[model samples]
Target: MKWVKIKKAEINEWNEKLKATHASFFQYPYYASGYTFFLFSKPLYIKLVNDQQQELGYSCILNVGAFPFKAGLIIRGPVFFKTNVDHRSSLIALKKFAVKERYTFLRVNANEPAIEELLNTDSEFEHKDYFPSYKGSQGIDLNIYYKPFDELLKSFRTDCRNKIRFANEKNYLFEKVKTSTDLEKVYDLFVGLGSKKKFSYRPLKSYTKIFKEGIKHELCSVYTASLDGRIICAAFIVKDSQSFTYFSGALELQNIPAKYSPANNLHYLIMQDCFYKEDRKIYNLSYSPRESGVYMFKTSFRPEEICKPGFYTYVINRKIAERIFSLQGKSISAIRTKLRSIIKLFNK
Candidate 1:
């Protein structure tokens, strides 16, 4: 087997090949471009081929962090076209590449259980205990698309169904975002929500590039809910051929009543559209802690829990990797413990 570096000009062809696998939007060249532009990470698209030169799989790796401490991250991928392919050989090749490039470690956070099982058995790959927040996601099966819309509505919890009905009764205008002005409005709401919730978000310029490129590729859709000429809620949904993922969203919380439910309504509309119109098979509600209010809201739609093996790291330079991991763990712990205070300082 050999690994070939795919060039920028050949990204579209690579993406087409990716569609043959169980790859998500994260492995797309556009997503890599967005991350590269925002985080200044170098994106490497590497394809694995057999001796006969037939493509077997590919991974979109991001070379991140400063030199001498840099790490390669394969987020949500290293997508293989077939289930029976030798996954171990691919990891071995990737590890060799990382060592040759002088990377401290290589991190993989693939959604595939097969890869996760392989990593668990491999002594070289250590499971990273940090970032435990994304162990699973909530997924709504869109197979009910064949049934009546009312049947799909009935699948949700009573309270959720009531919220959707309430939103409709209030004549909330829910529509697909069409213009840059609409996107700006959505970004403003996203920023406002982040501030209110004491969290951080990517800058608008990054979002602009992601949304623009994703829309051009038919891989993204932004939906908004408006009332009396003011946008109340918005969501960004990224999709592959089979599934639509609710990537990010925001709600205007200024004077909205609990019963108003624009956020819930927005998601309902999105799911409805994805099911009946887009012909998707799954609606991924994204990730949140099981104990969080966000999780409660997402569960009201009665989505099934979809779990995966979390992040794993393969050390290349043992001494450097251990030191970096120790510091990184402490830093992450400190941030989580003092997040509120940090947000306050930033606000001041």
Candidate 2:
């Protein structure tokens, strides 16, 4: 088995035109934002082949540079196109590729249980397992996700059902954002929600670009809920051919009209919209941590908590560099969290 670095355009074709069943939206070229989201990203499209060079399997990787070190993020990938490809050998080849490419470590969110197990027990690699960012994602299987709109309403918790009904009674509007003007209204609400949560929000331009590009690719949709013409809730959803994921959502929980749940109503509308589109397997409600308010709220929707593969990092030759990278990563995260809290306090 051999690992070869292909052109970025080839990666795009492999993901977009070739359409690997196991690849997720994150592996797509547009999703990377071409270094606008991160400082630098190197696209790796490796094909596993024999002496005759017939295609066996392929892995899509984004090697992102974090100043002193590089990390390869494999999101639900290394899909084997042919059945004969050995999972363990392909993974071993990937590790060698990472080290050869001078990456400090490789972080993979593999799609298969066998790949996860290999990362955990393989002697050729050293790694640790963390809760997957995509794990515990609350989602509904569209096959039986809902009934008629009325039955769907009945499925929700009493309080939630009431909130949606109350919002409608009050003439609240649910809209699918289609223009820049509409997006601006939703983005403002999103930014406000970010401030309240105290997490750093991306620049407005970044979001604008993402929305425009995503729309062009038919991969993104924005939904909003409004009360008396004032926007109160907004959500961003992304999807591939099979899965619709709630990528981001924001709303004013406190200032919204009493007994009217704009957020819940918006979610209902979004799900309905996705369902109408036809080819959907999972309606991913996004990641939620244990014991958090968001987790509890998502649970009320009755979506299953699906546990998937998580992050696995295999360090390369530079132990000293790995230590430095690890320290810097933790320190930066700590400082950012503290800073966000400080900013929130001052704003209040």
Which numbered prediction scores highest in TM-score against the true structure? Answer: 1
Residue by residue across 1-348, what tens digits does model 2's lDDT show?
Answer: 767766656654554542446556665555545335432344566777756877777666765544234556676766676776777888877877787877766667666777778877777555552212222123222222635656766777777777777877767777788987788887788778778888755556656766776777677788887776888778888766666778777777566555877777778777776666545656778766767877666766667656666567676646634453444445444533543454466567
> Candidate 2, clashing residue pairs?
none
lDDT of 1 by residue, 149-182 (tens): 7687788899988888777777788899887778
Model 2, residue 301: distance off in Å is 0.6
Residue 183 in candidate 2, Cα distance off native in Å: 2.8
TM-score of each candidate? 0.86, 0.80
TM-score quality measure for candidate 1: 0.86
Clashing residue pairs found in predicted model 1: none
Q: Judged by lDDT, which candidate is best?
A: 1
Worst 10 residues of 2 by lDDT: 131-140
Residue 28, model 1: Cα distance from true site in angstroms:
1.6
lDDT scores of the candidates, listed in order:
0.73, 0.64
